[model samples]
Target: MFDGVARWWDGFELWLAQQWFPVQFVLVAAVLLPLCVGMAWVIHRGVEAVADRLGRLCRADAAGNGHGVVDEGHGGRPDAVS
Candidate 1:
């Protein structure tokens, strides 16, 4: 059973790697380019999420009236002595 599964996977890999030139660019565009874009989009979203979370953490330590810090200056820092 394991050998059969291995054989099947090997055949699938060969099929996927086969270079049929007639529609090579189409296949690359359809399969590879979107894959890269999707991966990049996922990475961008993850970084944005991390940045938002870090911003929240930094804001949590700001000095204010406990309702969270309000941006009042060029650097978006909390108001002085608030």
Candidate 2:
């Protein structure tokens, strides 16, 4: 099975190499570029969401509020004693 897959891949690569350079470049730019960018965007958004949730959790813990309600000017830190 692995050998067959490798052989198929090799054939596909050879066929790709035989294509005109411009065609290959256009295919990559038109198809692969957008695909990579979209995937990156999705990953970045997912990471940002996780970070936001973690930040809220930390803030909630620090404030002892349990609700993650970040107050103004303190930046999620608990109020200081006068």
Candidate 3:
């Protein structure tokens, strides 16, 4: 069965190699376009999910840290009260 599949693949490769340049480009694009789009969509979704988790973590940290937030001009450190 493996031999058969390999032979068929070799034959197909030869046939594709003999095809015209435009035909080969079209055939490859037909397969690659959707594949690349799907991979990009998956990556985009993963990035969005990570961004959401990071945002949640940042909000939680801010809430847990209580007062003094960070950008209040104190430079994020405790004020000097000699």
Q: Where in model 2 is the C-alpha error above 4 Å? A: 65-69, 72-82
Each model's lDDT:
0.73, 0.78, 0.79
Better of 1 and 3 by lDDT: 3
Count residue pairs with overlapping backbones in model 2. Answer: 0
Deviation from truth (RMSD, Å), model 1: 6.5
- Tell me the tens digit of each residue's lDDT in model 1 across 1-82: 9999999989977876786766666766898888999999999999978876776667766644476655756454333455
Ten contiguous residues minimizing lDDT sum, candidate 3:
73-82
For candidate 2, the TM-score is 0.63
Ranking by TM-score: 3, 2, 1
Q: Highest lDDT among the candidates is held by which one?
A: 3
Tens-digit lDDT string for candidate 3 (1-81): 999999999999999999999999999999999999999999999997887677657756886789525443443333324
> What TM-score would every model get versus the actual structure?
0.54, 0.63, 0.76
Model 2: per-residue Cα lDDT over 9-34, one tens digit each: 99988987899999888866898889
Task: Tell how far residue 79 is off in model 3, in angstroms.
Answer: 29
